[model samples]
Target: AELSRLLVLKPEILLLDEPTNHLDLPAIIWLENFLRTTKCTIILVSHDIEFLDKNITRIFDISQNTINDFKGNYSKYIIFREKEIERQIRQKKNQDRYIKQTNMLIDKFRYKKNKASFAQTLIKRLEKMEKIEIDAFDISSINFQFPPPLHCGKIIFQSKMLKKTFGENIVFHDLDLDIYNGDRIAFVGKNGCGKTTLTRIINGELECEGYFKKGEKVIINYFAQNQNELLDPNMTIIEYIESIPTEKSVSQLRGLLGSFLFSGDSIYKNIKVLSGGEKAR
Candidate 1:
């Protein structure tokens, strides 16, 4: 509600750094839709892959002390980024051949007066040639893998005889469902059918007198999807993470954060200034 009011000014070129931080899924969706139609440019930094994918048109990627300019939305950026990397690799190969040839020629003829005659030209040639600019460091790499989640028996959670209704409208009634550990499902429905309400009920956040049971060893990490609301306009990334409880040593946290793809001075950055993608990462 507060953010909605704030956005009413329709600020242009919203320098949103992870604007979706504390927002719920619905709020995130609202932002996506708004940005899609909003005339202003949005410089979004977010780790919400899906949201960025759906809305953004440009990406300025800084890596290894150089900025990468890509000319489209995130999905297009992905396509072009891979191709650009390949292009850079090829450029390095070509640059290597140039350096090898130049060095060998210089070594072969450095001692003779006749060779010295051509040395000036050679020196000028080398000086004027473009320098090879390979990336200063390699981003980390490993085969992507998913961790084995704690295995529960057949049914992970169950809800029975669930019902919900607003003052004058019935959303759902007498619902029965069983969710298994390995099952991937989308709790989907049209707008205002209380799909989110069901999740809240199962999460025990809603007052439900009916049947709701949790299996053993359930570890729930609620990564609330509200990207826009999570942002504190004044907070930077490093400062914000320090405020949270972490088991990681500072160096360990730094290493882990690096793997998640943040780097350089990004650690010292404020949450408010970070893109949603950066924070999410």
Candidate 2:
């Protein structure tokens, strides 16, 4: 909705940061097309590799307190970055060798009275020489693993002749499917295709014209795309997590939050003050 509002303004330049956060696949596709055809200068900060590959024409990589501009998509920028790193390494090696040789000459001359003048000259030269420092590539990688799910029954859900419609617009008709335990499924289609609608119907959040059945011990934990919308803005991070019923201890909860990068004092921060990424976590 925010993206749509921004688009309607028809700004000559657009700046977006993680614009795809709550978007469904279809919405993302629409945005990709929109960006491709728009006559605006776009500046995007995104972690969506595929989206960046498809939409962006240039990249401004922030590293070592500098913005390195690359005239290409994310993939090309990656290639360029690797080559640049290699070049930097080579330059540093050469600079180190030169500095070492100069220092050795200075050291040899410093002791002799006759070479003292040359040593002073070399010392001055050394002082004037620009030192080369290698920027440390200390990139931190995040690893998150979900707890193994409980073993479910043979048939998790089965739907027959399922159909959904909003007024005159029909999303799906005569859809039949059998979902078993541990079955991974992904819904793909254009906007307003009723993917969410179908999920709601199956979850009993919405009524539908069809037959839907669930096996025994089938528990659904739905995480909406707009998950931040569900968070209590009035609650603090720790308080919000505590609000949910769990068997874990307070220390365990804190550890879990820490894994989400909400450590120490940050857990006390109010949900309203948290950024989009924090709220999402």
Top candidate on lDDT is: 2
lDDT of 2 by residue, 1-281 (tens): 77889999999999998888657777887889999999999998898998999998888778667777788899998887778778888998998888789889989999999999998998898799887665554354445788877777899989899888889888888999898988899976665677778777767788888888987888887877777899999999999999999999999899898888788899999999997777888
Q: What's each prediction's TM-score?
A: 0.63, 0.71
How far is 265's C-alpha from truth in model 2 (Å)? 3.8
Q: For this target, which candidate reaches the highest TM-score against the unseen true structure?
A: 2
**lDDT over C-alpha atoms for residue 173 of model 1:** 80
Each candidate's number of clashing pairs is 27, 0
lDDT of model 2, residue 23: 78
Please give, for residues 1-281, the per-residue lDDT of candidate 1 as tens digits: 66676588778767777677656577778888888888887787776778888887777777677777777777887777777778888998998798788778877777678897576667678888887665443445533344588766777788788777766677788888898888888875554667677777766667654687877787555544554566675776656666679786877666666666666887777666766556666
Instruction: Score residue 42 of candidate 2 by CA lDDT.
Output: 95
Model 1: ten consecutive residues of lowest lDDT: 136-145
